[model samples]
Target: MTTTLIFTQLTIREAQRRKILWVGLLMGLVFLALFAVGFHYIVAEMDKYASLEEALTITGVLLTAGLYAVDLLVILMAVLISVAAVSGEIESHTVDVLVTKPIHRWQIILGKWLGFAILLTLYILFLAGGLMLIVY
Candidate 1:
C-alpha cells in the first residue's frame, strides 16, 4: 500500500540518519576484517602445501564458512536494528507526527517490517557477495 511504502521509506531514512546504524556497520566491518585475515591465513597455508585440487577444496570449505559468518552477522544486525525500530521512534517523540497523520496502525507496522526485511536482505546479500568474491 502507499501508506506502507511511505512508512517504509520513512523508516529507512530514520535508520540511515541515526548513529547506531554506523556503529552496527562498524561491528560488521570489524567482522569482515577478521574474516579476511582468517581466510588469508587459510589460503596461505593451503598454497604452502596443498595441491591445486586440495587448495580448491579448502577454498570451498572456507567460502562456506565465510557465508555462515556473514549469516550470523546479518542476523545480529537485524536484531539490533529491529529491536529499536518502534521503540526508538516513540521514545524520541518522532512518532508524535505520525500519530497525527492519516496513517493506519497496520500500515505503520507493515512498513517497519518491510523496511527491516529489505534492509537485512540487502545487507546479507552484500556481505555474501563480498565473501564469495574473496573466496573465488
Candidate 2:
C-alpha cells in the first residue's frame, strides 16, 4: 500500500486503541443523561413559574447551550486525539519503522492529520445527532 494510506490506517488504529476515545464517549453519554434530568426538572419547575411558553423559551436557551457544549467537547477530543497520534507513535518507536520505508516524512504527517480529522468529524456528527434526539 501507499505510504499515505498506511499512515492513515495507523493513525486511525492508534486512536481506536487509546482509552481516551472510550473515556470521551462515556463523558458524552453522561452529559446527555445530566441534560435529560435537568430538562425534566426545568419542565416541572416551569409549571410553577408561570406560562408554558416562558418555560419553553428557557428550555430552548439551555438546550442550545448544551449543544454548544457538546461541540466544544468534540473539538477538544479531536485535538487531543490528533496531538497524541504522532507523539505517541514517536514515543513508541513505531514511527521509526514507517520512516525507514519509502515514505516521505511529510506524507506521514499529512496522512495522520487527515485520519484524525476524519475521526473528529465522525465524533462530532455522532454527538450532534445524539443531542438533537434528546432535545426533540
Q: What does candidate 2 score in Cα RMSD to the true structure?
A: 2.2
Candidate 2: list runs displaced more than 4 Å: 47-53
**Model 1 lDDT at residue 26:** 82
Off by over 4 Å in 1: 90-100
Query: What lDDT score belongs to each candidate, Candidate 1 first?
Result: 0.83, 0.81
Where does candidate 2 clash, by residue pair? none
Predicted model with the maximum TM-score: 1
lDDT by residue (tens digit), candidate 2, 1-136 = 3777877887888789988888888888888888888877877788897587887788789879988989888877977676766777789998899888777899998888878888887887777887777777
Model 1: lowest-lDDT 10 consecutive positions: 127-136
Best by lDDT: 1
The RMSD of every model to the true structure, in order and in angstroms, is 2.0, 2.2
Per-residue C-alpha lDDT of model 1 across residues 1-136, encoded as one tens digit per residue: 9999988898788778877677777877787778888888988888889999998888888888887888888877888778888888799998899889888889999999998888877787778877776676
